[model samples]
Target: MQALYDVPAPAKLNLFLHVVGKRPDGYHLLQSIFTLIDWADTLHFERRGDGRLARHDGADAMAELPEDDLCLRAARLLRTESGDAALGANIHLEKRLPAGAGMGGGSSDAASTLLALNRLWGLNWPLARLLPLGLKLGADVPFFLGGRNAFVEGIGEILHPVDLPAQTYFVLKPPTSIATQEIFSSPLLARSKSVAIVAGFPAHNSSDDKNESLQSTGAEVVKLDAQGVAKLCGGFGSNDLQKPAEAICPEVRQALQLLEARYGNSRMTGSGSAVFARVSSEEKDGMSNQSMATMLQDLPGAWTGKICRGLDRHPLSGWA
Candidate 1:
């Protein structure tokens, strides 16, 4: 193999996702602040001189079932654009992020594939040129190319960069899977939302504000060692589908209740099932990580939960 590609595809959280309306094409228009998280899946690619694409061992087993799998689809799309009929490669995907948790794992995987193959197949296109191709794969794919904290609007293709204070978060998920399309298509889905096309970015508390005002509002909130950063549960934000999701999936509700009761601030991440809470970094000074783990262990139920910190930014780059 003459060319090699390795990429990290990261997960995302909709800090505050709102449903403004629905498009005539059945796509829901949304406004959200998308923060990239550290959790991710990684994929590696290698080019074969012959015009034959193969998947390695277990990777082929996963790909054999779907011609339209995001990774394969991205490869084909990149090839079509480059007109490289003889271009072929082997892709190895290391799946880590949980699928259908509204974390954009598959979309990130697709974005990585498109970017990696553009180089491995010898297509020298800039990230901007590849974005539209990524959009064809999924709306969230383009955001991965932007690779920063973004204020996303439109059908989620529009992007504006924003600066958000980072903190540690405890992410929790119940044993339930949600179909994004199903949630978007239900009659119960809310569509009558006012458009939020502000001229400038939303304001966040700066360091001075964090010390004086942000910490005064709640007891559970804690300021980080850095200036103007608060680590707490509960946010000044919400997700659009949370109510509808709770109605359809009870496990999601149970997970939220459990998280909120222990930590006092918990909300769903993307669509459903996966919910998270803000944990004070300073809380460790008073208690240990093992104590927190024991807190969740004592909870009555069967669900998957983890204590992970929020990301200062997305984990990968197209050029990296």
Candidate 2:
């Protein structure tokens, strides 16, 4: 293919993020479950026979982005590893997901870049070969490349396939961006002591005492209905980083309050500056698109919000 148009890099929500431990190298060991969302950034790629890689992104977004962003870094790394100096591409990114919202926008884009370039350059690399290169780009990169919901651990390198029923969410991004370091370095960060069991879960609600009785029974995936989703997620832990994120960025707290007031519950996903609430099937059916749009229009300038649905896998899952 001469071009890959409208390639999507979907954002991820950490349904539950727990800081389990710390490595001697200073990287915090974490355990979380990541699920893809319908809200995503779109990328367009065209073969560049000139051997010059170029990324055309929104000027304002570029100003906010690091000089050597993940997209460029991914492209360079893939090309170098391919041992094909002549391979190049022109990448255009339509930045839809807000930056620093803890939604994995940049990492998803980088994953998409590697997948698109693999085909553009005729490398046809398998997922196994591409995964290590993805890790070098960012901790979240490999999860995106994994192409489905995952139980993530070990600084984001360990991943196990997870299955989540399709569900709706209301995600709100505040006007400000949060630097990840600010959240991690804070002394107020909390770590969870209890480990979450994801190997098996009930498909239906159980008695109070029976809830959260999960085990490693090799029953990972299940066919669940809308009501089953709540019981399944209730067993998962909370985002430990949320405490520090709210402290480091008051906007994170503000976003949480806003979502909670409307949706009845809200939690910070991943880190800070963005909060989300689960929308029940009845709530989603009653909500109209115009209402969702009006809510977003009411936000401050450059702030974004979306009524998104959880995805079964990345839109570009088959690309790699």
Candidate 3:
């Protein structure tokens, strides 16, 4: 049987997330910048002739996942869409990242599965061909598959690649898992009525780099104006869902405070629970794991924290 081993599913930090509007289908239209981080989960796949999809969980992943988790859904979706009935695999997941932290862990796993299995099964599908299947799994999945730090829009399907500087981050996952639906359903979500983008969003495609608006601060991130629109200068936009998430989960607030107290600034990544603070860039030699450990020593045993550097692209970016 052909197999793929030790495949990585890297996590993502949404530099900022903005809800621009609500679609007629009740889906919230969103704009965000997604950057990959070093922290990740691992997946392994073994090809099987028996046309049966199975999952074997490795230790350390949080609570029992649903029967139809995103991994299986991605596989099943790919198989069903491929017009091939006999393709199947036994998937092994060594999940280290915390779920429901809005870190895009599971979606990354699913995207990696599609990329790895496409190779293991010799389907040789391109990134474009696999992206639609990915979007069926989740909005975040396509960003991982796109394989770059991007300014994302259109309910998360439209991706505009951006040039981002390298930086270090300390991500904290408080002992709480937030329900994404709950946060989105909250009446307090800060969906902006009008959205203004930076100079170059997409005149046509990612290749149009003539007038891209990117301003830099010290180890800076992309920021937006108070009206919920991206600005041409420094600072990133807000994770609009953070307010609702904090209201629902007090741990979100606690985690934000802890990181802010130490790093001088902290913001919830995607939705809730996991908040991150910019550490130092590699030019500064980066933050040491030992120092991170020392700072986290007094925190509750249930909480999980990590010192991660940003990745230029997905590990399997070249696979498809």
Per-residue error at 8 for model 3, in Å?
Answer: 0.4
Give the range where candidate 1 is weakest over 10 consecutive residues by summed lDDT: 214-223
- What is the TM-score (0 to 1) of candidate 2? 0.88
Q: Which portions of model 1 show Cα errors greater than 4 Å?
A: 1-6, 57-65, 197-199, 202-237, 284-287, 292-302, 318-320
For model 3, the superposed segments whose C-alpha errors exceed 4 Å read: 59-67, 203-234, 282-289
Q: For model 1, state the Cα shift of residue 140 in Å.
A: 1.0
Clashing pairs in 1: 234-265
Per-residue lDDT for 25-117 in model 2, tens only?
A: 888878777889999999998887777787887653322235478888898899999888888787889998888889999999999999999
Report the error of model 1 at residue 175, Å: 1.3
**After superposing candidate 2, which stretches have Cα over 4 Å from the reference?**
59-67, 201-228, 231-235, 300-302
- Ranking the candidates on lDDT from highest down gives 2, 3, 1
Please tell me which predicted candidate would have the highest TM-score against the true structure. 2
Clash count per candidate: 1, 0, 4
Cα RMSD, each candidate:
6.5, 4.5, 5.7
